[model samples]
Target: MGTITTFQTTRRIVMGAGAIAKLGEEVRRLGGKRVMVVTDPGLAGTGLVDKVEDLLKRERIAFARFSDVEADPSYETAVRASEKVKEFKANVILGLGGGSAQDVAKVSSILATNTGGVSTMFGIDLVPKPGLKLILIPTTAGTGSEVTPIAILSDHHEKLKKGIVSQYLFPSVALLDPELTLGLPPSITVATGMDALIHAVEAYTSVNATPMTDMLAMQAITLVHGSIRTAFANGGDIEARSKMMEGSMLAGMAFANAGVTAVHAFAYPIGAEYHIPHGVANSIMLVPVMEFNMLGNIPKFANLAGMLGENVAGLSAREAALKAVEALRQLSKDLQVPARLSAFGVKDADIPGLAQGVMKVTRLLANNPRLLRLEDAERIYRCVL
Candidate 1:
């Protein structure tokens, strides 16, 4: 037996086309009278927020919109958002859009109730109480923020991305509408899909992997591997979009329990300092991190090769592991995601500091299959720089 483990995710997840239609009803079911709708500025302008407003209006739910959420949002942004929740006197916190918006919503939910600095809530299971009733609607088929009981915020002062891991961070309800993902640009689609894929990849290879998490992760990988290209090329395909969303959610559940490994740890520093998009940052670090990680668990890496649909017939586990890395490289190339840190303007001089940042993400690094040192981190950063 591995070890005693407990798995948790959002208790109620509503998935299908028009899942967003349940937004108002869900809020009402949660006994919410006044609602605070949180989303990013870009999504605010996209008429999706307008649809959300219309739903609440139809239900006669009193609501306010806070659309200032940004990509890799700062802790201050979350503080500001919580203040909005307070100002609105909202009984329900409705998080809309993708990861950033959802993460901000989670933070806002907790910060409203916790009555403490957001920084204090960072790290594992530190929040002492649940926040407002929360509902999450994911417009993009990535982040899995709706399901995962973790919210990440950027700490600009430290130039690092920090995560808040608390059961209270999980939304009371999650609404996944595949149609909401149709309007995503190809770039956004590809990046988010890769993020979803990497979540499963890392979870499958994590030292913390449990049997249930492994089941979730393997299925998530297969779903994403089959659906990502179709979704990327034809963003309007509902079937593809649905599968992508499902894959992302499954990946979220997998990583939520088993935890993601070094790829996320590596991505955070670049993402925080360089302002690389989260998915793109993960993509940039994926190959190098996996190449380094494969040595620790060649059998898992070999499994990844088969799951990613690489023909691993008649190959040794080590050889199949290399093929897994090759497959990720080819997929990144095909999807046109950044494959190197240099593309994000990360310089040779920045490697050491960035590696140092990676070390601070000990929560994630603890799950890494391979034990990594500071020098190893620096070398990994240099690999793509």
Candidate 2:
């Protein structure tokens, strides 16, 4: 048996169709009076921001809004948002929208309490103190930023995506309300759903996988497999949206504790360099990374294949693993996710640079079941390219 280590999740999660309504109560429970709501301009116009603001107002909670967060949020954007948090002297932060907003809010919380640039916190356990009272509400069924302790922010000057990993980064409360995801565009739905799948697949096959993480990852895989198509086809499908939310949350919890693997490590540089959406980058790299990692953990892949509804019964573990990769490839094709990095304008010469960047993502690379050398990372990039 693998050595069992203690696992910890700092966030208290409340999940349901209308969990967003509980935001005021949760904030008050944490003794937060002044709050900042961080989100994107698009969501701010959708009136979802107003709905949340109303909740706080009814509870007599004082708040401010920072709606400049963009997709694939940058370090500068986070720093700018942190300025608002500091100016308002906000005691609590409410992240409302997709992963971008949630990530920015988490970073702002840290910057509000800590005295340093955001870049200083990149890497493992670098933040010295716990972040402020943070409440995250994910409007998209992807990225799982609500429950995760890791946040990815782009560094435009460096042309790379940097991550901050620390137990202190987890939110004080994660409120997942599936109703908030009802109107997502089909394209966004497909990309984010696939991102959730990548998280489950990587966490399940991670070198650090524990029994607890395994259970959550496997269940998340099943939910994504069964509901992704329905959610993509009809964005208003409440039932499908609910399942995706649950799956994404579970995957986030599992990966946050067990760690992500090569897929995420490889995808980061792509997102940072090419301006690819985080979910789309993960979608493009998912199948290729799975193909590379299959040999390292055939049994896990076989189980994943079975979870995705592939007919792997009575097959050898190796064959089942191969089937799983093929199944994921087909799913991506059906969802209209680009099959290759070349499709996204990645050049042959960029492979070497990307490989170097992938090597720097040691926090994620260390969790991969298969050891990935620079050459292996380059090969994987070429395959996807």
Clashes per model (N, Cα, C within 3 A): 0, 0
lDDT value for model 2? 0.90
Task: Give the number of the best model, judged by TM-score.
Answer: 1
Model 2, position 215, has a per-residue lDDT of 93
Writing each residue's lDDT as its tens digit, candidate 2 over 1-385 gives: 9586767675489999888889889999999999999999999999989999999999999999999999889989999999999899899999999999999999999988888778789988899787789999999988998888888899888888888988878899999999999989989999899999889888899999999999999999999878999999988889999999999999998898888899989889999888788889988888888888888888888888889899987899999989999999899988988778887799999899999999998888889988889998899889878
Against the true structure, what is each candidate's TM-score?
0.98, 0.97
lDDT of 1: 0.92
Off by over 4 Å in 1: none
Window of ten residues with lowest summed lDDT in model 1: 337-346
* Residue 310 displacement in candidate 1 (angstroms): 1.6
**What lDDT does the true structure give each of the candidates?**
0.92, 0.90
User: Please, what's the RMSD in Å of model 1?
Assistant: 1.0
Q: Write the per-residue lDDT of candidate 1 for residues 1-385, one digit (tens) a residue.
A: 8467898999999999988878877888999899999999999998889988999999999999999999999999999999999998999999999999999999999988986688788889899999988999998877888999999999899998889999999999999989899999999999899999999999999998999999999999999989999999988889999999999999999999999999999999999998999998998899999999999999999989999889999999999999999999899999988767787788898888988999998999999999999999999998888
